[model samples]
Target: MLDIAKLARQMPEIGQQMQKDAQASVKRLEMAQQLFFQANEHQDNLIKAQELWCDRLIFSPGTPVESLDTAIDIPEAPPSHSVFSSDGSQIAPSHHEIIYCYLINIGRIMLHYGQNLHPLLDSIPEIYYKTEDLYGSRKWGIRTEEWMGYQRTLKEIQILTEMACTWVNPPGAHFNVPNLAMTDGSLAFWFLDTLPTEAREEILNPVIESWEQLRESKIPIVGYISASRSTEAISFLRLMACPYDVPNCNNYCSLDNEKNPCQKVEPLRDSSLWQKILQPRQRSAIFRSNSRILDFYPESQKTHFCYLHGGAEVARIEFPQWIAEDSELLNQALSITLTQIDKGFGYPVALAEAHNLAVVKGGDRTQFFSLIEDQMLRYGVRNVGVSYKEARKRGSIA
Candidate 1:
């Protein structure tokens, strides 16, 4: 376990001890690093590393895909007849089918899945697909309903938790049947494509196996990640470690991504790990900073960069690389939601977002700051203070 106390104390002295090295590590926080791919032999072996943990290795059929054959017989029927939308427009937003319950805290967050007429300040509505009469009365023990006006969307709530548990929990992280991997989207595929064969075998294969099994069985995956930011890492660990809080200790986003824009890929730069991978110019183009790389290339977007074996091939011939524009899509949101308060030196800013998962993609990690500012402006409420427990005690069913 990472000792937050030690990290906090040691952080101040790092620059003095190791100036250049510390600066380089800090520079990595910028999202413009290149993805490292292993040699052919290493690549082949990485695919084989899952002999122990998992039964077999495979990619999940996320979006429907029909692959081309060697013989190239009359091409199979396409997954979608046309890439355009109903209105015949080319651009179609890939609806976020999965929900990752990233920052759920029993103390900070109040989750109400089943019907219980209570609307705490932090209350979330879980919409149920079925009606109350069918099971609310007959199967009261399992499916009791209490007109949860605040939590009218049970299915949505359940799925969000499932997605959260899937990404954070590692394979075999919990004895209970686990949510192994995330929805293997284009970003993941692109990340996989850039991995070195050695790293792929050692670190990624087990993860890939976890994804494949979940896909085959329709089981949700626990997408595990560790925090890139120190503050976030501590907060996440604290919430998850508490027995009464976010169950399933899913450590998300601490792994080394060759193409991670946030981290400067210096150690492996020009190393054998990046042999025939993306070109240097293309590397700069794709490994951009402060852009939502996932949105840039989405499975729901186009056949942009989602090509793999037995899938729609997006090889180097068609689309050379994945590039992120200098677009701060959330800038407007952040400007409206964040607030400044008195603190030492300058001031501290508090950011928060209401419980929402449907349209809010990529967890509420970045949105909270944007949201807090917006809520304060509305209703002339600078800040309506409410604790987690206080919200649950509210009498309103909302």
Candidate 2:
């Protein structure tokens, strides 16, 4: 339980810290706004900023960045189109539960949009409890919640890939209609960055394979991130603030714990950078992600992103380079995304439905454990017991 009184006692200190932070943030915002208007003047600075961090591999330079002040109109949607989106939820391995099993539910939706909406497909939940499913004994020594979440993400991508393949090569009639495939978050697999090289490969191999299949199937795939705080693009502005040349800055920026000279834009986020430029129903220019993890993905599958402003906050939408390079494909993707947002009254309805189908509520988790206990008893296993704390909580009266 939380110590509310103790937390209350610290409120004064917390408030002071918050005020300091807010002041620093205000300074950063002022710097960003100044750069926003003078973006054309600092075009070369953005490029040099990327070059300075090029070796570090944390920055991906955006193209036509001189057009940062401009906003592109929302693209037109195809008359008839199909949209597929996938989302997943998982029940992490629990110590309090009788069984050591964990569950993952992946929800998929295929919606056809034209004159009116039509649900062409539904959600499918797949639960795995076998020893092989619970643990990654081959690579990981222990089963962890992080590993489970990674597996859940892999399944989500795999399902989206499978659906993309199926839709493109329908058993009877090919899906000639413009179709798009999307997942709920960033396409980059940043979660594996700290894992051992071999473990990262083991976890990402299937995901990469699925992505290859999806790309080969020619179905545009994108990852939708709402309220993104990514600063990849804004980091470019820091280069403009650098007092030295790009090469000199590179020399000064080293892995040997040298302080970066261009830390003036410390608190700026990408959405904030574009918020000053983009209007509702408009999108910013696409910029390729220079994430170090992109090295794991094939060159063709490198992710790129752009900021889109709906009636609400700026959203970052990531897609493979192939989709971004082709104008028609990019427009179709943008159109479908806007349509989804409109349908859901600000977000994608398909993803919303997929999340709804995949979410595992607290009550559902309780019933799941109860079912496990019942099955164990039915199998003549009587030693199963809940911890004392769990029992107390179960029996506690308000």
Candidate 3:
């Protein structure tokens, strides 16, 4: 059990430390804001810095697609449009359970605006119990949880693509409405970096295929991240602050750490910088991600992102290069996103609804295990049991 009394005794000291940290953070934010405006004024110089040192920079910084200071107000959405979103939930395989198995549940939603059509909401659940499914090849060295997560992400996009394709070619009616497809988080498979080359190819190939299908169907898809802590834009500012002719962190900073000039704008996120620059419903300039994983991705499917002030907070929206290059599609995507945020009162309604449908509560997990045990007993399986630790966690003797 937690020692509440001891924790209470330390609250005063914790509060004081937090207060001091907050003050320091405020000072850093002020310095960052000043540097941000200065960088904006000299966008040309920053572009030159990127040209000279982009390949050698240690940190991944965003490459601007347009002027660095560009901020565009949210465009008006089409009169009639559709929005499709998908989210996934997973029950990881655990040893304490009645069975060594896992489940993936994908919740998909479709919403139509300015039309009298009913919205579609449903979840598809799949179970995997085979040894090959549970533990992949030993040579891959991928953890079960990471592998399951990658599978879930792949399932989410595939489902989104299937739903959008159906919308594009409905059975009875011709739905001529412009549409947007979205998922819950970053589209870039950054975690694949941990896997071997063959393992990365196994996971990435299908995802890229789905992206290609969406592109062929002219359906714009995005990944929305709320209160994002990404520092790509801040890293760009650091490039602007480099006083040396060639911006090399390792060559100079490793020898003399105290004199590093970029530390002036230390510890501020991209969202913090945009919060000061963007008004509500405005979006900052789109920037291409410099993730090394994109080297494996096709040029057209490379990840690009922008920050939008969605009334309540700054949100990072990521999409493929195709959407980033098309003005009409980009505007349509941003407008629909802002509209969804308005309807959901800060977050996208489609995503929020999909999350509601995908989430597996504690009660549901308990019931799932109960169902498994009951089935095992019905089949006269004697191996069914729970770990002593699990049993102790379920009940206590006072």
- Candidate topping lDDT: 3
User: How would you encode candidate 3's per-residue C-alpha lDDT over 1-398 as one tens digit per residue?
Assistant: 89899889999999999999889888988888777778888877787778777766667788888787889998878879999999999899888777888889899999999998899999988887888887884568777777888888889988999998888876775777789998888988888876799988888999899899999988999999998889988888887677787787667565346546776766778888889889999999999998888989999999999999998999999999999999888888999999999999999999999998888788878888888889889989886788888889778785
Name the top TM-score candidate.
3
Candidate 2 residue lDDT tens string, 322-383: 77778788788888898888889999898899998888899988888888889899999998
> What digit string (tens of lDDT, one per residue) describes model 1 on residues 236-350?
1122122322122223322353422222333322112212322321211111111122233333222221111111111211111211111121111111111111111111111
Please list the Cα RMSD from the true structure of every candidate, rounded to 1 decimal place: 21.6, 3.3, 2.1
Candidate 2 stretches with Cα past 4 Å from truth are 1-27, 36-39, 42-49, 56-67, 115-122, 137-142, 247-260
Return the TM-score for each candidate structure.
Answer: 0.20, 0.87, 0.94
Provide the overall lDDT of each model, using Cα atoms, as 2-decimal numbers: 0.25, 0.77, 0.86
Q: Candidate 1, which segments miss by more than 4 Å at Cα? A: 1-12, 17-38, 45-398
